[model samples]
Target: MEIIKTAIDGVVIIKPRIFTDSRGYFFESFSQREFDEKVRPIQFVQDNESKSSYGVMRGLHYQKMPYTQSKLVRCVRGRVLDVAVDIRRGSPTFGRHVAAELSEDNHLQLFIPRGFAHGFAVLSDEAVFQYKCDNFYEPQSEGGIQLIDDTLGIDWRIPTDHAILSEKDIKRTKLADTPLDFDYNEDLYKK
Candidate 1:
């Protein structure tokens, strides 16, 4: 696997090696040993999956402290425009975001560390998105920033008018208005 660093610290893009032929393709989706050596040492306890159609967008979401999660996300089928936004207070790249195109063809995975908000937009007819999280879901700890927060200037690739979002997601507050409990600690994410 190859690791690609983003502008923001602690966020990385992984390109896994795929072996293909007439028989089809194969790749190691996750190997704990390789992950521990490349990315930081993280114990993923839960795995989640979501299926969405074109123009569907979800997120700009994160969990509050104590329940904050680090995720290894990928598009197992079809394609998506995955995004991660730094929400760590006092970090040099606070409010900045990194985006990558993940698809079954590319076999790319994105590693989003704790203290970042994550979301994705389906770019294909249908997308099967999967992720491994270091923490379990906590409904009460859920928090989100508006998907189209003007300050962030994100181009979802899909036209804004064409995007479909849930009522809860559409009602999310702007980043500046949202209350966050994370403070950037260099030691915690230096890896």
Candidate 2:
């Protein structure tokens, strides 16, 4: 596997080695030892999967302190415009986002550390998205910023009329109005 660093520190794009033939293909999605060596030391406690249809947009969401999560995400079927945004106040790339096309074709995985908001828009007929998280879900600590906040204009790569969003997302606050507790250079990403 090869890991590519994004503009922001600790955020990474992972490309796994794929073996393809006239018949099919094979690849090890995850290996504890290899992962520990390649990425930061993390012990993923939960694996979650979601299937969504075209035009479905989810996120710009994260959990507050004491419940923040680090994730390794990938698409197993179809495609999506995956996104991660830094919310660490003192960080150089605060409010900046990294967007990538994730699909079954490319077999890429994204590593989004704690203090980042993650979201995705389905670009295919349907998609099965999987992610491993280091922390468990905490409903009370959940928070979200508006996906269409003008400060961070993300092109979901889908027509506006085709886009579908949840009620919670529609009611989310703009980045400016959302309260944050993280500094960009906080202890979270220390080596």
Name the regions of candidate 1 deviating beyond 4 angstroms: 186-191
lDDT of 2 by residue, 53-159 (tens): 99999998898887888999999999999999999898888889999899999999999999899999999999999999988998999999998887997888888
The runs of at least 3 residues in candidate 2 whose Cα sits more than 4 Å from the true structure, single-residue gaps closed, are 189-191
RMSD of 2: 1.6
Model 2 worst lDDT window (10 residues)? 182-191
**CA lDDT, every model vs. true structure:** 0.92, 0.91
RMSD of each: 1.9, 1.6
Q: How many clashes does the backbone of model 2 have? A: 2
